[model samples]
Target: MGTATGSSFDTETLRRGVEGTTGNTLLSLYADDAQIRIIDRNTQPSHPKVLRGRGEIAAMLDDVYSRDMTHKLDRCVVQGDHAAYCESCEYGDGTRVLAESMITLRDGKIAEQILIQAWDE
Candidate 1:
C-alpha cells in the first residue's frame, strides 16, 4: 500500500475527487478502510452508516451510477487537511439536492465524511 500524505485533503484534491466522481466511478476507489463511516445528520436519529470496505463502498457508488445520476461540484474550500465542498446533483429518480460536506483525511486517506443536504428547489 502506498503511504498517504496528510496533505491529500487539500482543497484541490478534494474538489477534483468530488467533481471527478461520475456514474462510473467506484466508491472502493475512494475509500478502502474497513472503518469508513459516513454520517448524514439531517435525519432524526442521525443516520450513521458504515460502508465496510472499499468493495462495498464501490458497490454503493456503482448502484448510484447505474441510475445515471449527474453531479456538479459547485464550490470547494480547504483549510489545512480538511476540505468542504458543495455539490448540486440530480439523481435518476429526480431526487436533486445542493449538498455540502466536510471531509477529513488521515494519512492521505479519507478518514471521515459528514454531509448535509441543501437543496434549492
Candidate 2:
C-alpha cells in the first residue's frame, strides 16, 4: 500500500457517512462529478448500475440511508490516490448485506467508485 497524497480522506468521516441514517456526510465525501458503478445479483459486471454525478449518487444514498438498517465499515485500505473498503449492513427484518468498494480519489474526495454487494436471501 502506498502513502496518502496528503489529501483529506479521513476514515472517521467515512465511518460516520456510511453508518449514519442521513446521507449528508457520505455525499460530501464525493466529488461533484463523481461516478459510482454498482454490481450485485441484479446488476452484473457486463451491465452495472451506474450513477453519474452527485445528483444521482445523492439519490441512491438517500434511498439506502432511509431504509431501516444498520451499516458498519468493517475495514479500509488506502494507497496513493486510491482506497478500498468493506461494509456490512443488516436490515430490520434480519436481512444482511456485505459490500466491497474500490475508489479513486482526487483532491481528497472520491472521484470514481466501483462497488459489489451481496444480500442474504
Candidate 3:
C-alpha cells in the first residue's frame, strides 16, 4: 500500500477510477478500514445505509459496475484531507442517476464518505 506525502488527495487517480469500467480502479483509492454512508430514496438520511470496511465497499462497487450502465464523474474538488464530487450514471434503459459525495481522506485514501443520490423513477 502506497500513500502520498501528506494529506493531499489524488484527483487524477479519482478521475481515472471513476471513469473506468470496473470497480478495481476505484477500490484502490480506499483504505482497508474505510466506511461509506449512502442515502437514496430507499434509504433516507435519517437511517442511511452504511458500509464498513473494504469488503462491503468492494461488493457494492462490483455490483454497480457490473451492470450495463455508463458512469461519469461530472465534477470533483479536493482540499487538504477532504474532497467532494458529483457522479452521473445512466442505465441501459435510460434511467439516470445522479450522486454527490462528501469525503474525508486519510493517508491519501478515502477514509470515510457520505453519498447522496437520486434516480429517475
Candidate 4:
C-alpha cells in the first residue's frame, strides 16, 4: 500500500465520496490501505468476507455503480472519527435499500466501513 498524505475527513468529503459512488457518479474514494469486509446475516455461515486490497474494492464498486442509480442519504451523525448514516438507494431493475452504515477513519482517511442493508418494499 502506498502512503497517503494530506487526507482529511469532513462531512463534505465523506458525503461526496459516498454520494459520488452510490449516486451514479462512477467516482471512487479509498484509503491506500482500505479494506472492506461484509457478512450477510441472511446467508448461511455469516463470516466476514474481505474485499481485499484497495484496487479490488474500487473495481467492485465500479461494477456496482455501473448498475446502480440514485442514492439518497439522510439522518447523518458524526463525531470524531466515527459516523453513522442512513441511506435510501435505488439500483438496477427495481432493487432498493434502506441501509445504515458505520464509518471509521484512520489518520483522516477512511479506514473501515460497515453497512447493514434492508430491502425496502
Runs with alpha carbons beyond 4 Å of true place in candidate 1: 1-6, 10-31, 34-45, 92-94, 118-121
How well is each residue in 40-110 modelled by candidate 1, as lDDT tens digits? Answer: 44452255566666677667666655555677779866565555678887877787867676766566556
Candidate 4 residue-wise lDDT, 4-105, digit = tens: 234445556556655775522322345667776654555323666566657767776777566657666676776677667787778767777686777676
Ranking by lDDT: 2, 3, 4, 1
Off-target runs (Cα >4 Å) in candidate 3 are 1-7
Predictions in order: lDDT = 0.57, 0.92, 0.90, 0.62
For model 4, the superposed segments whose C-alpha errors exceed 4 Å read 1-8, 21-29, 41-45
State the displacement of the C-alpha of residue 80, model 1, in Å, after optimal TM-score superposition.
1.3
The residue pairs found clashing in candidate 4 are none
Ranking by TM-score: 2, 3, 4, 1
Worst lDDT 10-window in candidate 2: 1-10
TM-score between candidate 1 and the true structure? 0.65
- Cα lDDT of model 2 overall? 0.92
Best by TM-score: 2
Candidate 2 lDDT score at position 80: 85
lDDT for model 4, on a 0 to 1 scale? 0.62
Compared to the true structure, candidate 4 yields what TM-score?
0.71
